[model samples]
Target chain A: MNPADRALEDLFQEVGPERAPSHLHARILAQLADKAEIRTVPAPLLARWQWILIGLAAMGSILLAVMLPGNGSSTGWIALLMDHLPDMTSISSTLRTTLIGGAVISGILYVLDAQLNTRVRPTHG
Target chain B: MVYTVTHRILRNDMDAEEATQDTFLKAIRGLHTFQGGSRFSTWLYSVAYRTAISRSRLRRTEDRSLDEVEGRPGEPGSEAQGTTSDRRRALEHALSRLTPEDAAVVTFHYLHEMSVDEIVTATGLSASNVKVKLHRSRKKMLEILQEHLKEEVWTLRTE
Candidate 1:
């Protein structure tokens, strides 16, 4: 830093930190005492185990569908679909499209939520 | 420190006080997850800075210039401004001329003795961005300081 910059820093040092009000400390302590009981805020809607089970059920359904005996175009298409999981032109087109659409929309919503609600909730703990 | 930053940004006692409370509470709760990676003060400062920034955005009050002295607004170094030296008033005026974010950056980098990296962590700004802000703010402060000094000289010469 140049002398002028250093001098500016010195000026800031001179300015110093502003004093906080005396009551703020007391107010915070009282609020903390009140908030102590509700520290363990459970995630809303789906519980952890519930989500895991849902994921497993979806995977199982997909596996069962892939294995079910099929005739005609599905035979070769399933093999191709397995290779290209995102291929939406198979017998499982409706299911695949719905699942993929849901996932993508959920992801977009999640990102939007994260971005828009950057406001720190009063109880971030 | 938390109160100081918030007061500087919000320029309002009620808002700053509320933000200070929030910052302290968040810091206390977050203390458990603090893995001793950085100094405890740095971490606390980061929480304070974020809380202040958040509160400033949330606050609906009209913005005031840095040039506004304690009881007086607009007139940077009016007679009501009390016993502070002219240079100090000039610095404050210059500081107020910048955006609130830049003022906070200058405060964190200089008054608080925080490193560029620390500011980046505190403000969630990139390292390069912090450095650039510091550089630009310093230059602006220098220019403001010079103009203020010249005005002082002119006032004294007339007196």
Candidate 2:
């Protein structure tokens, strides 16, 4: 910048009020604490709505299967159906337990994604 | 320090205090992602600038209609009186009329005394952009001060 412009800007040095109120530092620190609290906040469990929906779906499916009329023969249609659905029954109980465990993991992930989305993205909030 | 920086931007003590708090909160939340690419002070200033800008924009938007009698938001304390105060107020009034980027240039250059390189790093603007902003802001400030002086002279003559 030119010397004249430099001098003009220098004039502003004497223009602003003195340092902002001292309590400002304490206030900022307090706010920082609040933010840390928010960031460290543990995520909430998955939505109760999701659990309710899954429960309702499972119950509805079970009722529908039981309510369906079956041939009244000695063929034991229910047993035959269960036998044909080998993929569901053949897995070790341990593997089945692991598959159920994945639901918990995915639920946590879903909740965390929702929380971060709401907090970080203003449009979503 | 946050308040000091924000006060420079907003020129309103209460608003500055609030903006300072918000800036620190934002900084804390994003602290994990703050790579050490720039000085901590510069990064902090950038955060403060953004917070203050957002707040003032919100205020302006909320009170959009000019007929709403937008009185100055805070009291003009004794701290903001005298020739020093008047000159500062004059500069501030003019500064408020400038764009946020322009006001930022004035603040960073004059109040912080940051060099061109420092400003470029702080604002993420190219050196040429910084120079252009600085030049334009300085010229605008000169015109503002001249108009202020002219008004003062006119007032004196009438008296």
Candidate 3:
């Protein structure tokens, strides 16, 4: 830029763009605070107790399933299917217990995932 | 910075203020979409410029009959009133008379000292377009100041 242009530009520096009103700054901060409040809140502890109770109920049900009589006394599809199939009586007891434990743990995880998704999940900036 | 950009483009406080608020909110909401390529401030100004321009366009389209009741937003010399210096007043008056985009471009270049590339990144305008706007706006403002001040001065004409 030439001297004239530089001088003209300098004049702009003497008086810059309009100053925003103080209320506008307060208003912006208020809105951001409102947003943080809405999004950053943690879920209540009562809901945490509910989740613990649910996990206990699932564990108790699994224990009941393991202790209950097998397909022998019942007449459902499993009983009929087991009647035709070769028995898992030949498998090791420890392996059968491990398989049952894995299935139960997977079911617990699925339920927990769904519950966590619907309820409070932490967020990052 | 965001407010100033919107203020120059919109030429009125209420709309410019609205646009400035909208720009920040939009930036917050859409921040995840921003890649790390540009500076955060540049990305922000990009959002601000687009929001202000779009709002300005919306205002124009909605008011096809025009809002003549207000009768021209703020006049050139009207805002320059309280300034302590005559030259500053003259420049403000001259800047106000340019097209809103040109005024904003000049303000970005002169007041903010933003480079042509930064302007292009912020405004989505081509580099040449920004250059042309700056060059023409500077020349035009100089003309306005010299002519206006010269005309206002008490002079004696020779025979």
**Strongest candidate by TM-score:** 3
Q: Backbone collision count in every prediction? A: 0, 0, 0
Which parts of model 1 have CA positions greater than 4 angstroms off? Answer: A36-125, B60-75, B78-88, B149-159
Interface RMSD of 3: 6.5
DockQ winner among the candidates?
3
Per-candidate iRMSD: 6.3, 7.2, 6.5
| Chain B TM-score in each of the candidates | 0.76, 0.71, 0.76
The recovered share of true contacts, given per candidate in order, is: 0.61, 0.47, 0.47
* lDDT digits (tens) for residues B29-57 of candidate 3: 78788998777877887898889888878
lDDT of 2 by residue, B1-159 (tens): 556556655656788888887877778777776789878888888888778877877776554464257754322334433366566666776676666667776788787777888777766778999988877777676665655644332132100
Candidates sorted by DockQ, best first = 3, 1, 2
DockQ of each: 0.24, 0.19, 0.27
Q: What ranges in model 2 sit over 4 Å off?
A: A16-18, A38-125, B63-82, B150-159
| Model 1 Cα interface RMS deviation (Å) | 6.3
Candidate 2 chain A lowest-lDDT run of ten: A65-74
Q: What tens digits encode model 1's per-residue C-alpha lDDT throughout A2-69?
A: 56656777777876777778888878888777663334433335444655665566565656454443
Instruction: Locate the minimum summed-lDDT window of 10 residues in model 2 chain B.
Output: B150-159
Quantify all predictions' global Cα lDDT against the true fold: 0.67, 0.63, 0.69
